[model samples]
Target: MAADRGARLGFGLAASVLAADVATKAAIVAWVEYGARHEWLPILNIVHVLNRGAAFSFLHDAGGWQRFFFIAIALAASVFLAILMRRPGSSQPERMAFGLILGGALANMFDRIGRGAVVDWIDFHWGAHHWPAFNVADIGITVGAALIVFHELFGRRRVSEVNG
Candidate 1:
């Protein structure tokens, strides 16, 4: 990020990701019966399952305290992301990365607050092995994290070298 360029704003992309994530979750909850599983394809499934814990249902079976813990974490992370988004020297990709993270974090936080768990419905599997279910928020977070990593590796290095 050049001094003149400052930080790129990415509220629109973040908002769109949030909207799409919430909309899809709403549709899934409204139409799909809880615990229902549909094999959309040989390798994919559309199911309605509540995840009480983090990725892959870790700590899902814990009594119930994990809920508050996760909420706190997401809330803190969102605040930090907002700060990063406002930094003057942040680049476009960096801003987008933060935006995507913010959207997904808030979306999942909504679920954790409302339902005590996140709604996960996308499942991938082979004959006997099945991947854990995930949703749009998860996708956004995954991609956003990747983007941040990309910027840290190639983007920032190239910029520094060019300037020097």
Candidate 2:
């Protein structure tokens, strides 16, 4: 019963993340002109940009093979996360984290397959220094990773206490 509930929660969250990522990316593509930037706040900007590489545009200039490479990696990661979410004895938080990571990976993979690049629009900047633009999927992945780290460091103790 617990496993079923965990699976439901994890899958539901994954679907939500995927939907938001897709919708936001589509809206940005439809409404914003490519390469155009609009200031939304002192520290934020809305822009239409595509990333051809991994996080921080790593290897963005590495010709074209990186697209397929990244797609492969995303597929493998998504599969692994799905398996983790379904594993017996997994905690709710762990399931949720896996779901987030899976959703983000799948979202980015879809972008790579359909558009040949991932859409990145949210940009934060201060003076001349600017953070790389990213989308909803990146948020899911980043948060999920942090959650997993936090759980590993602190949450395991609580679980041990309850189960021991």
Candidate 3:
């Protein structure tokens, strides 16, 4: 029963996040030309950029094999996350966290396969310093990871109060 609930929660969150991420990417690409920026806030802008590599453009200069490498990694992680989500007795929060990460990973993998690169548009900068521009998919993954960490640090303590 718990497994079923977790599976449903996981799939639902994953699908919703994937849809939002894809839709936003499409809209951004349609409205903004590549490498162009539109400042929406003093510290934020929307810029269309293609990242052909991993985080921070790691391996971006490597011939072309990095694409396949990342694809395989995403594929494996998606499978593992799905398995974890459906594991018997898993909590809803755990499943939801996996869902978000799964959605983001799959979304980026789709970009890697279809566009040959991920489309990123959100940009944040501080005066002379700039942070990597990422998309909604990245947010999903980051937030999901943070939730998992929070569960580990605090959520489990609450659970222990009930079980232990």
Candidate 4:
């Protein structure tokens, strides 16, 4: 019963977060253009951009192979996440974290497959210092990763407790 509940909750959170992430990306595409920026604050801006590679724009400059490679990796990661979610004794936090990670990966992968690039827009800067432009899916991945790390570090059930 607990496992079933965890699966439902995890999948629900994944669906909502992924949908919001994708929808926001689509909105950025519709309302913003490449090389354009809308200053929301002195330190924050929304700039339309596309990435053809992985996190932090790794391999972003690759000619064409990056798309295939990234898509393959995202699909594999999503599959592995699904398998983990199905295993008995999966913790709720771990399941939720993995679901978010999988959803974010798949969302970005869909964009790469459909548009040949991942859409990015949110930007932050203070004078000359600037952070990398990112999007909703990236945010999900980062937050999910943090949650996973926290759960592993502090939320795990001890082996003795599990056996008892």
Candidate 5:
């Protein structure tokens, strides 16, 4: 029963993240012209850019094969995450982490299928340096990965202490 409840919670969170990611990307496409940038703050800008490759735009200019490659990876990751979320031993945090990663992967996969690239808009910069532009899907993936790392570092220790 706990496992079932955890699955439901994970699925629900995944759905919410997916919905938000899709909506935000759609809005960016509709409102921001391709290659155009709008200053949002001293350190931020809203822009429309298409990434045809993996994170940090790796292989973005490597012809066009990277698109399908990334889609395949996302699909694989989504399947793995779904399986992890359904594991009976998975705690709530672990389930949530898997859900977030699954949602982000699915969102990016859909973009690769429908748009031929991932739409990135959020930009952060300081002076002459700039961070790679990313979207909501990236946020979910990053945060989820961080959560998993945090749990691995601290959660296990706490559990062991309690058992002792």
Candidate 6:
């Protein structure tokens, strides 16, 4: 009973986050266009940019090959994450981390495969220094990665104290 509830919690978080990511991307596509910039802060702006490749825009201009490569990579990642989630004794935090990563990856993968690119909008810049434009799924993966680190650090401390 408890295990079922735990699984649901992880899956629920994943579904919500993934849906939010996809919906936000759809909104961005509906509203923003390439090179159209809207400033939210002196250092932050929303400018639609479609990423046709992987992280750091790798192979962004590989004609059409990048599409298949990226889709395959995302599929592989999702499968790997599912296996990790099913591992015996996986804790809630671990599951949540995997869920976030999987959801985010799948969201972007769907866009890349269906649209041939991923929509990116949030832009950060400071005095000519710029960070890559990214969308909600990117944010999800980043936050999820941070949470994994948090879990590893604090989770270990708690376990040691309890067993000590």
Give the distance in Å from residue 144's predicted Cα in candidate 4 to where it truly belongs: 1.0
lDDT of each residue in 17-38, candidate 3, tens digit only: 8999899999988888889998
Answer with 3 or 4, whichever has the higher TM-score.
3
Model 2, span 1-164: residue lDDT tens = 89989988998888989999999999999999999999999999999999999999998889999999999999999888888888887899999999988889999999999999999999999987899999999999999999999999999999889989
lDDT values of the candidates? 0.87, 0.94, 0.91, 0.86, 0.92, 0.83
TM-score of each: 0.92, 0.97, 0.96, 0.93, 0.97, 0.90
Q: What residue runs in model 3 are displaced by over 4 Å at the alpha carbon?
A: none
Sort the predicted structures by TM-score, highest score first: 2, 5, 3, 4, 1, 6
Give the lowest summed-lDDT range of ten residues in model 5.
8-17
lDDT of 2 at 92: 94
Show where candidate 6 strays beyond 4 Å: none
- Model 5, residue 120: distance off in Å is 0.3
Model 6, span 25-55: residue lDDT tens:
8888788876699989999998888999877
lDDT of model number 3 = 0.91
lDDT tens per residue, model 1, 36-126: 9998999999999999998889999998999999999999999998788878767888888888888889899999999999999899999
RMSD in angstroms, all models?
2.2, 0.9, 1.0, 1.8, 0.9, 1.7
Error of 2 at 5 (Å): 1.0
User: How does candidate 4 score on lDDT?
Assistant: 0.86
Cα misplacement distance, residue 47 of candidate 3 (Å): 0.3
